[model samples]
Target chain A: MAVLEVRGLEVRYPRASAPALRGIDLSLDRERLVVVGANGSGKTTLVRTVLGLVRPSAGWVRFDGRDVRTISGETGVSTNLAEVYRLISLPVRDLVEIVARLKGGDPAELEARLREFELGEVLGRRLFELSTGEQKIVGDLFAVSFGPRLVLLDEPFDNVDFSRRRRFVRLIRELRADLLLNTHELELIAQLDGWRLALMFEGRFLGPFAAADLDRLYLTRGTRADALAVMETSLGTFSVTRDSGDRPVKSATSLNALVESLA
Target chain B: MNLWRPYTKAMLANGSLWFWAFAFMAFWLAVGAFVESSGVGPGRSAVVAYTTSWYAVIVLLSLSMLAVAIANSLTYGSSALAYAFRFSRLTPEGYFGSIVGGSAVMGAALSFVLLGATAGMFGGRFRLLLLPADPAGLLAVSLLGGVFFMALAVTMILLVINYLGLKSTNFTGFLPLVLSITLGNAQIYLALPSWFVYGSPFNDLASLLYQGYAGTPATVELGAASVALTWEYLVVGILVWTAVLGASSLVLLRQIRSRQLEEGRQI
Candidate 1:
């Protein structure tokens, strides 16, 4: 049974010229799903909709067959979205304790887990006092510290140092919860082998292909439609379109190349 | 999470807030005492009336500052940390309750400081001239007034952001504090009708505080004539306003979209 389902989801912000999310359909259970997208591609919007933070203009989102809004308290969904780091006035320790208590987890246990990342010294420091990378690490640590049923991390590697990013990827791989991570870092696809991959462009999703198939995929200029390219993966073939003019496309194997072609 | 302890600790940690809550009122009280000691008034009764009135205004302003601070905590603090509440077992009601509880405790402690200071300062010469007639009543009025102002400020600020489509700026926060202080002291500056004066929660709260401190029914000095405010009128006004504002705040809380708050569209 699907633990999470988002069907025909469309979110249109007030006075927004274009919808933030359009016809997003997803189903996740225990599989690790990685969504790759650029900025303003609606990855955060999709995550917020799933978390019941943003109401959709169309369709519905459900967790365990119940509406997401009604079952949010029971779902144990956690996220590392930047909004979680907005409480700059609070010490990292207070924020962690508050989150742990709210999640019904022991604060001491969560703190002990965060200490594993060498975040112990910064625990007493206010969030605003830390570097951006440190703030992101704190958010990521709390998102996974409680062993939630599902974890949704948006751009978890952004601003993080390469060494910390490597450690974070290792930590994420060890988690038992279903994971839905979205980022523009293409190299992560090879590191997180066996994970499912989806390419998002302007509020739409393109694929759920195997992460391992990324190296085998190819992109070529689209002739039949207004698209960035026609991508061929292990599963099937599809055209990737954007809101703007397309760039010259070549045989693309790396995700970065594909993104550049789309760009 | 233990909301009370954390909220209290967070509030107490703010040194500037402490300065405003204590130092501002202490400064005024010192000036009042100096005036009283200098024998500046016409008679003992006149001096006592002036001192009590001064104390009431100073306390009201102090409470206003505290109330605005609580509202800010509810607005900006919640806006910043809303994601924590959304993903946790803690309900919106629980979070709201904790903030209110923590603020009420702070307000009560401050009231005691004001009361203790007033009694200690005035007890020497005036024989409890400026001390509250009923310390318990004054505390009760402080708690009620503190919560009411917080609710009013929160509702007004949220309405401006959510309905008026205004961004939560420093002006939005300041508007409520200004409006509250003006309305709270309107009777002192303006000679409004008896009904208009007593019907307003701000005036009613002021009257109750005055009554608690002066040991007499609060009299609205309307230029030439005066109207004594009754206990029934003041209590009813406060209760009704608190209930309405509190319910409105809860309704607005339910309608809040975390995305808007995350986007910095709300406080």
Candidate 2:
């Protein structure tokens, strides 16, 4: 089952001249999906909309075949006492504690998680006092603790250092939830394995292109092509007979080479 | 101690402003007390009334202004601070609770300092002086007066912000403190109305500072029960202000949460 499915989604900010997003449809199962676009191309808006942070003007979002609205989206590990720990103004340790309680994580397990992220020493510091990078790591840790069915991150690497960025790439790959990340760095995109790629342009989904197809499309051409060209060039040109629909041209260059060329 | 760290940071950051305000009031009160002590008849009486009243108004007014300044600064600076910290762990409720809770603590600390200075300048009497009408009435007046007046000011501020959405560049977070102080001061000067000295908290608090100059005890009388009741009322009023602000905090927190959710931003 698709972990996340956004269908014909549209979002318009109040008093804005145009919609921030115009009909966007995409889906992901347990696979990681990287959403890439230039600034103001609605990448962050799309992620936020999927997470139920921003309401969609039209269309629906579902997580694991359930509408997002009905999902009882409790973010922390343990939702009850979690609210209290969150209330107290503690530092990194406080965050770990909240994560532990909400997620029902073992204290030892949490401390290990904290150590893994290099935040073990800063556990005693307050949230307001940490540097931007440190804080983002903590935030990422918190999101990971939720064990969410679908995880959406907006600019997760903005404040992350290079070392941490590599760690985060590994973390994203390891996250049990289906992942949807909106980011601009193509380098990060190159690091992922088996993730779908969604290219957005002018508030529309340009491609839910398979990695292979996208590689072929980009290699043969400077950029990803429209649906028809993507199918023709990557799959091969084909002619349709009156009696039969379009057929693949099997004798053409290997489809693998087409993808490899694009890669 | 850790709980107080954020509050203390706020105090230290703006410590100079608070000190300046206290110094200004101290100077004004000292000047009045000196004039009265000099035994100039008309001057003494004039200083006794006007100076004492002004002292009450100025102290609360300065405190209120300072409180507003600090809160407004924090609110406007929060966005940059949020980005700087990368601490997205705090829910909107948590973030706002800390800020508001910190402000309240700051207010309480300042109020206590003012109270101590005023009491010390007098004979260490903490209770506000009521013009004895009936012992019971005097006590009732003090208690209800403190509560009614503070709650009124707090409620008004909340209403203004809720309706206005704190977006007005001019008002934002500062107006509540300003309006609370201004109205509070006005009510203090015009006491003994509304069947129970409407602004008596100011009058009572102010009278403490001026009490050192009050050589004559002025036949003040009130029954013991009324006096006790009045003290209870004042305590309760202060508590009510605390409670109302705390309760209303949840509502504001939720409002902010809803707003952020709409924008796809976490608190």
Best candidate per lDDT, number? 1
Best model per DockQ:
1
**Model 2: per-residue Cα lDDT over B1-267, one tens digit each:** 122345345454565656765666566555544543354335434433443444445545555555455444433333322221122234444444444444444544554455445434422221233222233332333233333333333333434343443444345445544554554455434433322322234434333323322332111224332221133344444455546655665454333211221222223
Model 1, position A106: C-alpha lDDT score:
81
Give the Cα error of residue A77 in candidate 2, in Å. Answer: 9.0
Q: Candidate 2 chain B, which ten residues in sequence have the lowest lDDT sum?
A: B256-265
Alpha carbon lDDT of residue B134, candidate 2?
A: 34
Q: List the residue pairs that clash in candidate 1.
A: B75-B267
- Local accuracy of candidate 2 as per-residue lDDT tens digits, A108-195: 6656776997778878887667787776666666566645555667667877889888987887787677777776665566677677
Per-residue lDDT, model 2, residue B120, is: 48
Reference contacts reproduced by model 2: 0.00
Q: lDDT per prediction?
A: 0.71, 0.49
| DockQ scores of the candidates | 0.43, 0.10
